[model samples]
Each structure stands twice: as C-alpha cells, then as structure tokens.
Target: MAAEAKQTCYEGSSVQSFRFFLEHSGEHQAILQRVHDILPGEFKRIGAGKSSLDFLGVGSGGGELDVQMLTLLQSIFPAVPITADTVEGSSQLTDNFKALVAKTTNLQKIPFCWHIMKCEDYEKQVKAKGDMKKFDFIHMIQMIYYVDNLSTTIKFYHSLLKNNGRLMIINEAANGGWDILWKTYKKELCVDAITEYRSSGEILACLKSQGLKYEEHVIPNTFDITECFNPSSQTGQRLLNFMTATDNFYQSFTPEIRAGILDLLRNKCSTEKDGRVLFNSNLSCILVYA
Candidate 1:
C-alpha cells in the first residue's frame, strides 16, 4: 500500500517554510514595488468625499503588505478615519501582524479588527450574524488557491464592496511555475483537504463570467531555487517543502515521485543561469470595481 503524503498546512513547520519561501523568492519585493507604484493612482479615485474608509485584507499573511496599503490609503485621505479588518487562518501570522501593528507608529490611530479564521469560516460567520459591513478596499494576495469554490468566494467578496469600491487580487499567472506545478502534480501532490490550484487566469475568467469589469497587470518575478537541487541543504529542503506544499516532501513521497517533481521544477518550471535555478514566479494583479 502506498503511504499518503502529508500536507504542509497541518504542520507547524509550514510557517517557517513559508517565511523561507517569501525571503528567497522575489515575488514579495516585486509585488511591494508594484503596490507602491499603483496604489497612489488607485487610491486617488477610491473613497472620494467619504469621511472614513473601510479596508479588508483577506488571507493577509503577517500584515506587512496590508500595513503598506493602509499607510498609502491614510496618506491619500489623511483627515478620514480608516478601519482595517484582517482575515488570516494562521494564529501565528495573526499574532505577527498584531505585533507589527503595535510597533508601527502611524498605524496607532487606525482601528484594526483581526479575525483568526479561514475565509470560508469568516464568510459563514458573517452570514450567521447578518453582518452588512461594506468595504472601500479589499485585497486578497496569494491566497485564492485555498478557497473551496472560486466563483462563490469571488461573488461573496464582490458583494461586500461599496459604491466605487475596489477589490484587488494578486495570484500566480497561468503560464508561471505555479500553474505548471499544480497542473502536473495536482493528483500526486494536492490531496486531502487542499483542492483549488487556481491562478489569475481563472480569476479573470470568473470575473468575466459574472459580467464584471476588471483590469489586469502582470508582475514578473522569480524564485532563486538553486538550493532546492541540493539534497543536504536544509534551506533548500524547506523551499522544496513549500513549493510542493508538503511537509518534508523528499521524505514523504516515493523516490520516483520526488525525482519527477525535481525534474519538472528544474527543467520545465525554471531556467538555469550562472549556476542558479530561477523559477518563474510571475504573478498577476486583478482590479475589480464595484
């Protein structure tokens, strides 16, 4: 009998692996830079004439990007109060976000409400409580793959938008490494509770299907995965674990499966340059207006 592969989501080590992935990959830096460039223009038109603004951060990991967006929003509307709500499934991440808020001097004036739960659970709670809070800005970054139903989740969030409000989503591009990874190994790697392995392409299609208008921007990024080829490297092992979304992937799966994944990641999903394996981590940002 074949042993079942364990999911990283259930392991405490997944957090460290995720942090390592973010540190090694250029995805975060590229998105941060893009956000800085785009938000000034985007915020200019949002919440005009409003005395206050409500911002929602769905699956906001650690709140670094959320804080950056909030800072930009505050700058655009200095006199207006902004209430920030964050939904994160990880307790450790929520605590890290709260700790960041405590240290940030500018965020002291802003009111923050933290929901330590998954987006589905949060939605269920909202329905159960009949919560009718509309948000001026809602941002979901690199987190859509965890959703149970893509279209339903999008429609649910879109319904929470106020007039002229915007919902921003950042996810991997269809032609990127993630798409290849998921498409190739979904049956072998993506099992148990994890199912949705979507990208920006699906998001755009969903928006169009619902007759919603949206603007899309591609953000080119890469992950230096040279270490992942090194079997003895702990960092490389962690990176592989994160990339595969499995805890100790090399140890969990059969050697044949491991070799196949490595080959695909090295040859198909990444390009080698100067002895470095750079995985295509290109992302897409979709902006949908209410």
Candidate 2:
C-alpha cells in the first residue's frame, strides 16, 4: 500500500472516503471503462457538440465508481462544463466522498457540485437551470433500488435531458440479486417495488412510459468477488482472512444465522480438495435519452 493509503489519510475527510475505496481496490479504471463501454462512440460525438453536460448520479456513491466516471469525463471532454449532482437521501457516506474529492485530480478540476439531495429535488435544480430538458446526461446507478417509485424516477431522469442528451442505468451483473436477497432475508430494501431488482424488461417498460428513446444490451462480464484469491487452493486461508478483516456476512445475522451463512458462502466458494472457487457477475447497462 502507498504511504497515504496505509495511514488515515482522510479518515475524517468525508469527501475522500469514496475515492479511497476505489483507489485501494484498484477498481476505478476497470469499472469506469465497463460503464463507459455501454455508451457507443456516437454518444461521445453527440456529447462533444454540446455546450454543457450534466451527470446526475441517481445514487452518486462516494467510492470508486464515482471517481472512475469523473476520470472518464475529464478524459473525453477535458474541459467541457460538467455539473454532476450525486444525490443521496442519507449523508452517512459524505466523508468518504470528501476524501476522494480532495485527492482526486480530475474531481478537483471541476467544481464539486454535490446537492446532498434527492432525485425529487433535481426538478427544482433542473427548473433553475432553465428546463428539465436541458441536461446532457442523467444517470442512476444502483440507486433505483432506493427509489419509492421506479417509474416515477425513470420519468424524472428522462425529463432532465435535452432532446439529444443521454440517460444511463447500471446495475449489478444480476438484476436478480435483489430478488435472491429478499427471498432469503426478511429485511426490506428502500424501493417501493415488491420486486428486489429491475430486469431489462422492467427498465424498458419505464422508458416507454416516459416516451424516451433508449438502447439496451446484455453486457457480458465477470469479476472475481475475492479477486485472485481462492479459499480452497493455496490461497484459501488468505482469502478467508481477507474477508474476516471486514464485518462481512455477520452484520445482518444472529450468531447461529451468521455461522450458517458463512458455512454456505464458504462451502459454495470452494472445498478442501480441488478447483478454485470462481464467482461470476453480470453488469447490465441501459442507455436512454439520446
């Protein structure tokens, strides 16, 4: 680890918190490109022609993903006006975000235009900007789950775009993560939908309701949740140790429940004998607006 990373470089600095996670994990560039790949080259040509651009992080998290996106924006547009609003209902992650902003060269270049707000408030900002129709791009990543009404949020995002602007949606490899979690756990996510996650069909339905033109693709991809570590092979204990470092699966459960969850997760991960445990993930990307 670098000297700064090893220390509490920005422990109390809320802004840098999100930046640290991305840099520490070395995931910023990779995930940024993954989301970037969803947009065709044509979108850039279209975006380049615009006078100003906006990125509305539906749930603009404070970590790696945010940094990565900002980096790409700098790379592609360099100095075009980018006013990004990362709206979140809760400010628990603000410190992380602050730390990230402090250290990130790209983020520092642009003014930190965090609303510390919610999607509903976006309309006010949109109105103030002239029209809800003037934004270049509006994105909601892993945040639609927190929305009380998916259709309403979708409509809101679409409303923020100029005729040629873009709206992007990204979620985990599986929309079914929510479904699976809900089935197994009684605790509910914030989404008003009884369904845990939105599928491509579900997302498309939202787009159509808003009368927005859009594109969809099954972005085939995978990431080893444990990175190169394998619990069953020579790295087995090391992998377990890495997981142990964090609270991991124990937070949500009683002692017995946690033990059972660990056994299941670990067993599914690998065994004492042969192959390494490899996990697969799917990242879905949806492009809307222009």
Tens digits of per-residue lDDT, candidate 1, 1-290, equal 00112431222656676776777786678999988877888888887788889999998888889988998898888899999999888788788889999998899999999988889888999999997789999999988877889999999999999999999999999878889988898897667545757878889999999999889888888878898889999988878877777667787789998999899999999999998999999999889999
Mark the 10 consecutive residues where model 1 has the least summed lDDT.
1-10
Show model 1 residue runs off by greater than 4 Å: 1-11
Task: Please give the distance, in angstroms, between residue 216's alpha carbon in candidate 1 and its true position after superposition.
Answer: 0.5
If scored against the real structure, what TM-score would every candidate get? 0.94, 0.64
Q: List the candidate 2 regions with Cα displacement exceeding 4 Å.
A: 1-30, 39-43, 121-133, 173-201, 209-211, 219-274
Best model per lDDT: 1
Q: In candidate 1, which residue pairs clash?
A: none
Clashing residue pair totals per candidate (backbone < 3 A): 0, 18
